[model samples]
Target: MNLNIMGPLAVNELISMDTNLLLAFFIGVGSGFVLESCGFSSSRKLVGVFYGYDTVVLKVFFTGAITAMLGLLFFSLFGWIDLNLVYVNELFLWSTLIGGVVMGAGFITGGFCPGTSFCGAAIGKKDAMVFIIGLFIGVAIFMAGILCGRDYTRPHS
Candidate 1:
């Protein structure tokens, strides 16, 4: 007996672009609300884990990661989703290592992760606003440097 099973509903086909955007907006707002409610929006609370005072962030992050991984594995196994269709970035060893190091350093020094910074900013925290501004400036400088380097390397004919 052959069992017919449909795997992975096509979201793009079912949802209009506007509706998708609206849903994303609502989800982001909900996530922000939850984070703020949990005190995750506070830099002091976030950095408490590093100081060995609080481990809520670490626990929640690990638990969420593990749960998502198990859910995906089960979904794939039961033919509810195709793992091959999942997006995965190509490995660039040196870039990945450098990025991780930079991000780790930033997190340690800033006392807030990007998500937490956004949440903090949402709640009118001045420090979080500064951090967010700094991030934007950093990105702008990086882009400018990249463009300059590319121009220098271009072949002039």
Candidate 2:
């Protein structure tokens, strides 16, 4: 049996590990199936967090974030996970601050974080799908208008 495992990458770098694209696709399918089965792919259920109806959404998310963060820190401390090889998010100071504010606003208004929204969409939530679509289009158009090159394209009499 031949397989490309961790092709061209160190054994510890799972992100760089290689495998069949088909396998990856199936893995995603399995994951989506699990999420759907767990009832995460519902928008109204997610939005219930804001109306004092459900805390499951917020609790699950916070727990997951804390779990992952703690796992990474613990692993790094024990020399299991390589801190140097980990990818750290780039900080464009202004963009990062503004992005965080926008994200927080989304959480407050939509009563769902990005992950929840994605999960909701996966289960065929029409509102989630529309929200996700509009989010992408809005960001795209906003960026286009804000790009510095727009100034040069302005009509000068």
**Winner by TM-score:** 1
TM per candidate: 0.82, 0.64
Tens digit per residue, CA lDDT, model 2, 1-157: 4343322134354453355455577877876675666556776676677788877667766886899799888877665656676677765666567767887787666655555667778667777787787678867876787684563222322
Clashing pairs in 2: none
lDDT of each: 0.79, 0.66
On a 0 to 100 scale, what is the lDDT of residue 54 in model 1?
86
Clashes of 2: 0
After superposition on all C-alphas, the RMSD of every candidate to the true structure, in Å, is: 4.9, 7.1
lDDT of 2: 0.66
State the lDDT at 49 in candidate 2. 75
